[model samples]
Target: MPKYPAREPLVLLPCRLPASLVARFAERAREQGVTLSDVLRAHLTVDEAKPLGKAVPRKRAGLAKVSGADPKLLRQLVGMGNNLNQIAKLANIASKTAQPMAMVELLITLKGIEKSLEKLSES
Candidate 1:
């Protein structure tokens, strides 16, 4: 008996697709009892006249209009990262020196960092 099924070698074609279109393809595949890849292959294999499956509607404009990140927010993230590193160093030293108060201070600093992150995400 063969350990693996015989099949052609396949390559992955990664792509970004809209949620609605992906849902439609998934529904079609379910209805026909086939994988999404099978549905895509059928659609791609066309004759001279037309392709398989109904044509999807044209995508809307401004769908990929993403603005650049704010410089201020980037700086804030960097500062927060530095604060975390400092806290980690302090935590190690406090543990070695048996300082409970230093550990408490580190915990407070971590809470502040969490709050700052929450506020940043909200904006």
Candidate 2:
């Protein structure tokens, strides 16, 4: 099986179309070396996939314009409040790992955190 970047799962979206047009659209997508989803996304409002060059400036300006800003850099700011809570839990686990039971617990905690980080980073 081919591997792809770990991304958000595919969401089923409903659309109205004649059967013939839908079949033709699918065929055209195959000929163009892309999936039907790719064709749909190209013509749809794909906000998340906007070019980073455009996104970065817009996000930065929007964030900076807030009266209370600057505690964190732009990249750090998105979804950051949740990140801090996760980091604190990790540190607490590490600090309590001197004894054997504590060490095992810490290992489990660390593993769970690793998986969570992998999911978030992929996003």
The candidate that wins on TM-score is 1
lDDT of 2 by residue, 1-123 (tens): 234468957689987979897788799799899988777666565565566554443335455577456645555545554665775676677677645666566567667767766786787
Clashing pairs in 2: none
Which stretches of candidate 2 lie above 4 Å from their native place?
Answer: 1-10, 46-123
Query: Stretches of candidate 1 above 4 Å error?
Result: 1-67
Displacement of the residue 53 alpha carbon in candidate 2, Å: 36
lDDT of 1 by residue, 1-123 (tens): 112245856779898979998899899999999889877666653354364698799876442243366666666777889889999999999999999999999999899889988997897
Q: How far is 57's C-alpha from truth in model 1 (Å)?
A: 50
TM-score of each: 0.44, 0.27
Local accuracy by lDDT, each model: 0.79, 0.67
